[model samples]
Target: MRDLLGDQVLDLLLERSKDGKGGLRLTGEGSMLGELVKSVLERALEAELSSHLGYGKHDPAGHGTGNSRNGKIGKTVQTGVGPVRLAVPRDRAGTFEPVLVPKRAGRISGGLDDMIISLYAHGMSVRDIQHHLRQIYEVELSHEAISNITDAVLEEVRAWQARPLEAIYPVVFLDAIVVKVRDNHSVQAKPAYLAVGIDTDGEKHVLGIWLAKTPLDHATAGESSRFWSAVMTDLKNRGVRDILIACTDGLAGFEDAIHHAFPHTTVQTCVVHLIRNALRPVARRDRAAVAAELKKIYTAPSAEAAFDALADFTASDWGAKYPQAGRVFEAAWDRFTPFFAFSPAVRKLLYTTNGIESLNYQLRKVTKARGHFPGDDAVVKLLWLAIINIEDKRARERAAHKEKTGKIKNSPSTARLIEGQRTIGWREALIELDIAYPGRIR
Candidate 1:
């Protein structure tokens, strides 16, 4: 390539790419070194550009403004990163609003800050992520700075959680992931439930987040129905008139909770959860083989075929040792079969808790580092915020739909979207939850 293209050509390429940081120069031994040097310079500049932080009168970042003749601070631009640059406004009136250019007091891009928020969602401790930022980007990020970035999600979470929802969700997937939270002034881990609804329009939206002090303490004990009941009440208040199908991980009373709340909802067990539970009972060495065989059950061409595989599984060598695992299958057999009711596209989406559990995995990554939250409010705040930011990536998973008319995609449409209240008649089928979870409907 060097032989074909002269070093002068490489030098010209280097000059074009450089943005005033040291331009690349050809070294004594190397050919076209200047271009490589320019590339490094441009990348560093791009990195700083991406990390630019934002500012405003209500900036939560706590970057206090300074006094100037026109009572204006330097202006800066926001990039994909989390930080904002303080571009010096040309007009002393501080009226200039630069869109994508350099400004005074230029700071690094906010992307690292954005990453910090994501790491927080993944359950990284601010202290740890701060240290992480230091190690990764060599930036001295403060706890408050990191917290402030993540806290921005709270406003978004609040808006989403309180936003009016669709009247009916044709299919809803329910699942919970436990994360440690500071509860009751003690740092303790809690189970936070994540619910996702596939609307009649085939749009998947996360309904809300619910937290439980402990998995054992969730709803089964007479004291509280856990966060599920509260979530149900919230849905009702928000006008969730009907829920057609509910998929879950067979969490204790989760099905019952849905049954009681929606009354007519068809509660299905997550096929994936059933598989995981079934495999747990198999021997470590033989588990993979057992799982392979078990896969035939759910993955079979039809429910009949799946049941045939199930029967075969029961007759297999591992059945005795992993009997309880098979029972998990037996218990969920009715719920698991619902997937067979839908077309392949819908069936694949509904049979598993993939929609909600993926969100939960994101939730766990954010909350995992914290041993526990301060209290129920703190738990609620963090989880709600985490869900919003996490779900913001929803479009990546979604197909192109007609854009809606709302500043926020999750916000309610001007025209109401309530659906028919066709009950799945689960109340007569499942146990009735007499517990009343009281809360103001948003």
Candidate 2:
């Protein structure tokens, strides 16, 4: 590469790098490095045009050749150091294509697009990215240009959303996080539903994300059955034949939605959500006492025993004071008792929607800064970038752990939307799940 620049250009570059104060400036605006890059690229393009025309410039043996240098076109390209202006040699035949710097391309440097995507993934807005590039790289980019770079990933997001899934998921957690989006000339909160499925191997995968078309009602704060049914049908269409246990936060009609798509699946209402709702009406001082009593019902030896515990709690003073607490458990008793049928190890995984909630927590961190998204596509774009960022970070962590320990760690205390890490005690839970549902594990 340096040989292509030749000695004269190299010496000029070095001479230009020195400042009047005896310092060297190799980066930022008007840097010698940018100038060197510009010079090399222009030289390379000229060489390519010469090779295409089958002769050297101004040394043609025949003057009647069909194609010749018509003139030069002025172009500016983005580089890591900064933007560089260049004069690309043109040909009369219009068939000379430059490989070093392709026509109609604004960026010539590799990894610049990926860097912009990484910033967008980490929650930097388009304006933020524009300012960052100008301030740090001394390169100016318009908001539309930055958006165009990030928008390139929308196709990848579509492909990922429509990708095929495993025939069976041992456990799938369903949940949604509300994001404010512009709708009907106003900003409204809309739920972006997500499903995180634990494959037969116990590794987690985010099945897909669906943005609600209409805003959710803040008064009811309930998820729509129609929206979830479409999401579930999308999963079914994508090749999820069965889900052994589906855990949810008791969203409205969530049970029916799951059952409508996968009739045999067991829907387990999230026990933690239940506990939180039951304690909503309790005073702060009495919440601890009330929670201990509520724990007895979920921790009992069997479903019958758990019912007995619930009855006993209803008769106790704390339950008498907070009757609505016991009623909250009774309201969702059918969905809540499915986990009790399994052993403690399996019940631990089935009893809560913590896995999906943790994923929502990470997504919220990415979207929290935005006052409202311009549209559903914008919301999906940002969230999809955030998911890619998360999976990439996890991949690096796993690779580092494997390098240091010579083996990968699989035991995470809670189920996470990580591809390689397995849920702790999943082997034992799988054994129980396999026995509980014959032929479904496959």
Candidate 3:
């Protein structure tokens, strides 16, 4: 329903229902708002019939047609406020299908659908949603009814997964989270891969999601490479011709797969992930100092400086005791030092898989509620719904920020100014990319 129409109807109801004792009064059973909604819906149904018949009521165009309106049929539909009795138009040919509310739909209000979807997205289970409806709206819906409503988004998820992507993404962050799904009647942990991309304009977008074919113990080089190869192949198939930088955790074989998929793409290991991994072998008493020393490498002015710091760290007491930590850094040195080549702004984006990691955090909240999904599709559906809600919240935040700062979200040049920063490394980073990659930016 149009917001303006609903607001106008609400205003009319409130103004006419004033107690006339200079105070507001409650609009009960035959309330104007309820009646107005019923009237509008009935009129819309009539309009649908008219269009299907190719003429207005009693018009000459429908005179000889066998699809002319027969008479009105009584159908009591449930609305947000209460049950509304509507006289639906019917035709002789029975070809008129109401687009506003399908014939099989008992509840006709858009408000109810929004409420159900919002509740589901907020982590309410099916039973919890049903309870909310019953307790608040006094409407008892069957399990089938609620399932049908939520399952309607399956096709949406499918289409979103298959949608074409941008030709070029300056940066893409890849990561995964484990979700339990039923496999051959037994539940098992499976990885769901997420790719988040930064468009040419600096806005963030989720590229797509992929579920690994097998239940891998960890994101090993062989396993991660195979999974990422499939993901990159799909992205390329969907129009992603080039990706400049890919930020990822130290998943073995990931960098090689990236090079093979998008030959020129630079793969940066998430410095945060490296820090976390390095801290694992350090003694708790020495963790703080070890973390402090590790920070010097990532935050160093250049790769040479970072290497120098690493060399110094290896000779330190903590490094000698927790030699594994140094070895871990050494193992991923190539991927870890790529961020030092770029400006701080670009480094801020490329130095971590935190983009997709944050997304995984949100997905975890929803998936955690379900002990195990019935199947992979169920896992995808819940995560997809959660992603939609997350994106919506982010959009609202962006809009509010724009209202407060009067700066557009997509404006790369003014973004730093809006963010109250001296430089937005992204623009300069793009220039460096153009010079480095040659013809890849456009």
Task: Provide backbone clash counts, one per model.
Answer: 46, 0, 1
TM-score of each model, paired residue for residue:
0.57, 0.89, 0.75
Question: What is the overall TM-score of model 1 with all chains considered together?
Answer: 0.57
Give the Cα lDDT of each candidate.
0.58, 0.84, 0.76
Q: What is the lDDT ranking, best to worst?
A: 2, 3, 1
Give the higher-TM-score candidate: 1 or 2. Answer: 2
lDDT of 3 by residue, 60-140 (tens): 887667778889888766666555678888888888789986787788757777778778888788888888777655566
Task: Please give the lDDT score for candidate 2.
Answer: 0.84
User: Superposing all C-alpha atoms, what RMSD in Å does each candidate have to the true structure?
Assistant: 12.8, 3.3, 6.0
Enumerate residue pairs that collide in model 3.
221-252
Candidate achieving the largest TM-score = 2
lDDT of 1: 0.58
Cα-based lDDT at residue 310, candidate 1? 83
What is candidate 2's TM-score against the reference? 0.89
- Ranked candidates (TM-score, high to low): 2, 3, 1
- Residue 166 of model 2, lDDT score: 95
Which whole-number lDDT from 0 to 100 does residue 382 have in model 1? 70
RMSD of 2: 3.3
